[model samples]
Target: MAESKDLLQVLWSGADVLRGKMDANEYKTYLLGLIFYKYLSDSYLAKVYDLLNDETPDDLQEAQKQYEEVMKTEDAKDLLQELRESMHYTLEPDMTYVSILNDAKGNSFNREKLQAAFNRIQESDELFNGLFADVDLYSNRLGTGDQKQSATIAEVIKVLDGADLIHAKGDVLGNAYEYLIGQFASETGKKAGEFYTPHGPAQILCRIAMTGQENKRGLQVYDPCMGSGSLMLSCRNYSTEPDYIKYYGQELMPSTYNLARMNMFLHRVHPENQHLRNGDTLDADWPTDEETEFDVVTMNPPYSAKWSAAEGFKQDERFMDYGGKLAPKSKADYAFLLHGFYHLKQTGTMAIVLPHGVLFRGAAEGTIRETLLKNGSIYAVIGLPANMFYNTSIPTCIVVLKKHREGRDVLFIDASNLYEKEKKQNVMNEEHIDKVLELYNNRKSVDKLAYLASYEDIKANDFNLNIPRYVDTSEEEDEVDIKALTNSIKETNKAIKESNTALVDMLNNLTFSSSETETAINEFIEILKEV
Candidate 1:
């Protein structure tokens, strides 16, 4: 923990120097861009030394001849292996982190050298063509003055040079990036909440989505509103073969879209297996004509937002099957849900976090809810505590949908009370999260926390997926003992009368107010009896 703290301190110093001089949002790009450059440079350095030591002729000509021979064999010159052979690329004479830093000596303080180095890095690898596309060093958000910009760049480079990012693992960097996103969410409040889910609540949702799917391999997973790709990455963490988990998702925000893509690459999810698209998922533009499908679909889309549900979509395959009555344009909660469900494979499962209103709201949303339950697409509803999101205080729920059902009953988990309050935020610790996952796996009825709602019961309620309608989390009013309450109130009234009488007698002996004191005693006894 102390080492982690030290690492953060090292990173923080760079951020602190740029605090008032740079916009908080723009600062992340500079820091993250440098970290990625360091990552690639370290990867390059690690392999070059290995090539120099490999068994070959000490003579440069002989070694060159042997290296060429080695490259011609079947599966001989893989790009990754070749990259390890030398710290070289199709770039101008001097273009690397070391070169950029060395150039930053006296004149490099203004840092045109660093920008040139970044250009070469981006141009060298087609695989990383658009990787740093969003990191704009020339953006005005860094500040208007050259002094401020130069100072910020110098501070950033100094921090990067001081830190040993080469020795750090990708997970460590990814974790730090996630931490920064969380901090931004808190600092930016409502705007940040638009693209972020609190890490703790996101973790609980991820734990639930990932349960019972551990041993699976080559599992296809997706998120409709994949902000920062946190939920999808969490699913990867739960996989027995994490490397085999293929990620797919969509985001409407361009900045968040970039972050999600970077997150996939940062975690080392092969670029080919990642299918993140930047667009409204309800009208996904992925090459779905290929019949691509996912086995796990998890998301926490913006609570309730509007969409066009354009008339052309009436003939589209996804909404066409729902009798052409699109989910109203005012609330597209069910629209996103339907999109995910449509993309889910026959054997797949989907878990979505939504405002609880979806369960009981009337009109178009209610109609869609009825259709899903009646068709047996929904499998469970887990109620979460209020304020689980960063800026919103509204209570929410997770709706679990499945293309295939193992049983006829729907599980209802009333977990609204299973959270600890930390400062002003409600958090679900590992125990609370584990309990929800445990109950979900058992699929059995627990007295209060969980109950299996039969299909008939759900039908009787007109297919309202409201958890309280099924699970009964209403505390039972402490059993309401009328007999005991009456007995206790009567005894309390008699005791009050005796105490008042003693006070009245003492007043009379002092010749104060005998009649008035008696009346006051009677009024006090009557009020006590009413209780």
Candidate 2:
């Protein structure tokens, strides 16, 4: 764990070199894009070395010489082809990070070389197309002129080159990349909502979505609002066959969409298994001709961004089933929800993060909530603490939904106060996450903390699915003793009287030669009597 922290620190230090050159949001593109490039290059070289070892088993020195020689000749074509089939991308010998660093050390490196490398990478596969588009090599943010821009990028490359990315375990490098994204999220404040979800709640969603699928293979996990692909990747934690899980996601922002693609590759997820798209998930429907239903769907979309909510949408398949009313045009919370729920397989489970208003808001939202509850679509609601997310402190909840649940009971977990305060945000430790998961998996009620509400119970409340209504977490007030309080007041008054009498005596014992002194002592005695 300590080593991981150290590695993260080293990787993040590269960002520090660019701190003054650009904003955290912009500089993150350069830093993360370069790190991802380095990873791809290192990964390619590692595969080459492994293959070389297989060819020359006895002599390590001979293998090194042969590896360099073959990479320069047409003989390396077969190896590159095999790598393309497996890794889905290839890096030329001169395009590697090592070559860039060596040239930078000789003061011969420039932004044009990096630009060429990025162009070649994007051309290598459809997965990498426009992957580095956000990392503008010649942007003025780096510097005003070509010399300044080249120097800054060169310095960044030199710093990243110091880190041992090639030999480190895949998780170690992937984790470092995630750490940088989180740091950027913290610095970006509310804008972080566009591209990042805090790790704790993400874990809860993944675990809830993966319940009963522990032994399942070729599991399909998806996130419609996949910000940097963190939640989509979190599903790997619950599955024994992490590599077999196919990842699918969509992001609205072009830059964030690119980030999600880079995130997938950095984690070593195969290109064929990743189906990420860049567009408005609500404005345009995706996976249109492919298998629309997914085994697990997770989302942390914008809280209440406005959408068309047009009358035309009433005919749309996703919202049409939930009565004629659509989520208010002013708030599209339900629109995002219904979109994700539409893609959920009948046997699949979905977990989505939403604001508290969705639980009790009336009008169109209320009707949608009622429709879902009556059909047994909603499963559980877990209330998270305030300030738990980087985007907002409005206190959010994760609603777990199943298409056709056997039972009509909805589990409500009031974990609003179950968090530790950090410098700028509230955080849920592993213990807190596990407790919620345990209570959720148990599917039974725990006093105050959790409640299992039957459909009849919800009907009595007019279908208000607010968590506090179902699971009360308020503390019980201490009972007051009237007799004990009266006795105590009398005892306190008795002491005051006794002390006043003594003070009066002391005042009388003082000699008063002047008329003024005598008048003051008389006043003091009267005041003591009143006390």
Task: Assess candidate 1 and give its lDDT.
Answer: 0.71
- The C-alpha stretches of model 1 lying farther than 4 A from their native spots are 1-5, 53-81, 84-94, 103-107, 124-130, 139-144, 289-291, 478-531
- Judging by lDDT against the true structure, name the best candidate: 2
- Considering only N, C-alpha and C atoms within 3 Å, which residue pairs clash in candidate 2? none
User: Per-residue alpha-carbon lDDT of model 1 for 351-413, expressed as tens digits?
Assistant: 888888888887767777777776788888899989878868899988888876655578999
Ten consecutive residues with minimal summed lDDT in candidate 2?
Answer: 55-64
Give candidates' CA RMSD values in order: 6.2, 2.7
| Candidate 2 lDDT over residue span 470-529, tens digit each | 887778998989999999999999999999998899888898789998998898899889
My TM-score estimates for the predictions, one after another, are: 0.83, 0.93
Shift in Å, residue 374, candidate 2: 0.8
Candidate 2 residue runs with Cα over 4 Å from true position? 1-3, 50-68, 71-87, 507-528
Clash pairs detected, candidate 1:
none
Look at candidate 1 and tell me the lDDT of residue 25. 67
